[model samples]
Target: MAGVQDQLEIKFRLTDGSDIGPKSFPTAASVATLKETVLAQWPKEKENGPRTVKDVKLISAGRILENSRTIGECRSPLCDVPGGVTTMHVVVQPPSTEKDKKAAHLPKQNKCVCVIL
Candidate 1:
């Protein structure tokens, strides 16, 4: 068994357009469980809608993660799943940007600015 500190620290983007990180959980944690954790941190909730874990890509040490065929593979210690390192980079894009009232109705455009994050 792995200790609390031994657990892998998974960091990934959530569907709600936020960056979550350093989530310490056992390697056996399911994708569904991770999804729930993401939802818990979500700013808002939808009454009825379809949610799927699509485009699930793993990233580690500035490289894209491969060979993650199963939940176990995703949490494998042999892989980059410890030391507070991020092994996945998830892009969560919701159908509607209604939550972003400031830019909800704005057209899609790029701005020239530096985001610290």
Candidate 2:
């Protein structure tokens, strides 16, 4: 049987400098699952919260956590102290609109387009 040492304590650090938890989770839990938990536990008072799981991004040790990766796999020695709680930054980015998408695909021009008469 897995003991307490097998579990990890994690807290999500919001952009507003608030935290969601120091909740204990099994190492087997997936990052996607954690995102779902974040969505569920998100503060009702906070504005511009994530509307979907895809909108949530978890960053640890300066790297974004992949949904397919398990919590155990995502553990960073730099952030995950043996008995201390690990704090991961949560970034909520809304899905890009068509306008934003179009702009992203637009080619960058090196020369100035302005012509003086």
Using all chains and alpha carbons, the TM-scores for the candidates as numbered come to: 0.44, 0.86
Compared with the true structure, all predictions reach lDDT values of: 0.53, 0.93
By lDDT, who's the top model here? 2
- What is the Cα root-mean-square deviation between model 2 and the actual structure? 2.9
User: Which stretch of 10 consecutive residues in model 2 shows the poorest summed lDDT?
Assistant: 1-10
Clash number by candidate, in order: 0, 0
Full-model lDDT, candidate 2: 0.93
Q: TM-score: which candidate is best?
A: 2
Q: Model 1 off-target regions past 4 Å? A: 1-6, 14-18, 44-71, 76-81, 93-117
TM-score, cand. 2 vs. native: 0.86
lDDT of 2 at 52: 91
Tens-digit lDDT track of model 1 for 1-117: 347554667766544545666567665666666655655554455342235444343444445444324345454445563465654555444555557885867798877889796
Writing each residue's lDDT as its tens digit, candidate 2 over 1-117 gives: 357768999999999999999899899999999999999999999999999999999999999999999999988877678878999899999889999999999998789597889
